[model samples]
Target: MTRGDDYVLGRGLADSVRLDAQHLLWKMHKGYELHPLIPRTDNMKIAEIGTGTGIWLFDIARQLPSSVQLHGFDISDNQYPSKELWPKNVSLGLLNSLIDPPAHLVGQYDVVHLRMWVPNIRGNDTSALIQHVKSLLKPGGYIQWEDADLVHQYVKGPKAQEFERRINKIFDKAGLDFRWVSDIPDRLTEKGFLVLESESGRFELDSIQECTKTYLLVLREYINGFKKLPDLDIQQMAKEEEIALDQLYLQYSHGIVYNWSPVSLLGRRDD
Candidate 1:
């Protein structure tokens, strides 16, 4: 089956828009594209796995020198930008990072980046997938990863908390586990990578109303995407989640939003 076939979230225009918006929101929250601790040199190569829309690379490109090569690989290229639109140094291709990278790409990049792969991580075990990513990195290369800390998601009232629980249940049905994001540093350390820094920040709705709404819209899109899946039970679960979210919104007419923390870490391959 194609990589897209295994993806629970449907690939569509709305999904693309969500990815792009989510990228900006994350950048705003984190305050930097590439971590400041990650040293940059001339002619450096960077790769972002599961690069939806290649938006992160495009944004990072503006901050780096034109000579720095940026590569984006995704399972599906449905959201990739057209030729001539992205930076000349930015190249995008199809490669499922969960699998062993091609020999030509082995130990090729100076740095590898991944974001929001929680759903894509099939099992609780990440050893094989971590090895796959390590194979793509050169000795002493860095891996910068960012993902939501859903395990610590919180809401104000009991109703809001119920909404969070129902949303998590949908994630569980989809075979997604947010707990893995918390273990990234340990996983990297086990693979002979030095865990340099691991940090997290909350997506506070009180601070940026627009960003908060965008995040909710992204979650709703996931529920909507589930409806498009081939499985009937999952579709029914999505229907229930949709109704729950709507009821929560109605109950709290002013606003009802859950806070999710995002974790980002920098690790380096031990030479």
Candidate 2:
């Protein structure tokens, strides 16, 4: 696979990783809960940063009783749905978070929600991005962030731990902090948000076999991204890891469970 194709595959795999039963329960109970509290009115303006597939935005709009105005911003246009299925209240905008918010969007939203932004946040100067998010929020508005503490993957098992360590080390070497989720709430607070709530959940399966097939497909794509490296030892190790991951997938297909952990941080922009 080419680099672009590999990247697309990685994104697709990550998105396909479903929120299991427990997550569905929380999502249902929470009304797709927003941190710092849900907006009091359906007419509130909402902005979703890095809306993966626009599914969440569409669902939220469908749930609201009033005419909610929604905007989704992403670097990739891939997240948008077909025009025929688009909601009347929703619009899609191309945005590069590393840069300033577009002139049209400044101080325009009531809720600014950002999820799974770890990759971009780690790749760029997050302080600037945080400030940009802040600027986009209206006074007393809220910003919710959902990300994972990837380093916690190390605690899952020997193989998983090693994988987590290696991935994080690579990210660190690339000037990205893979563990940024652990500090995001505090960072938001420092950025002037009143942290209302922060919680984390873990997903543990009986074995990697439980989720191996799905996981391997993802791994194959991710590995492709690094296949161009010149280091012989690294390439050899990656090959071995790929084999192991594939084996785990086989086991999962038979009936095994894999564990994952994700976190949610919600806060309000102080008036």
Number of the top-ranking candidate, with lDDT as the measure: 1
> Among all windows of ten consecutive residues in candidate 2, which has the lowest summed lDDT?
1-10
TM-scores for the candidates: 0.90, 0.78
Residue 28's lDDT within candidate 2 is 42
Best by TM-score: 1
Tell me the tens digit of each residue's lDDT in model 1 across 16-105.
887888787787787899988888898999999889899999999999999999999988888888978989999999887766788999
Per-residue error at 105 for model 2, in Å? 0.4
Question: Candidate 1: misplaced stretches above 4 Å?
Answer: 1-5, 204-211, 228-231, 247-253
List the RMSD of every prediction in angstroms. 2.5, 4.6
Backbone collision count in every prediction? 0, 12
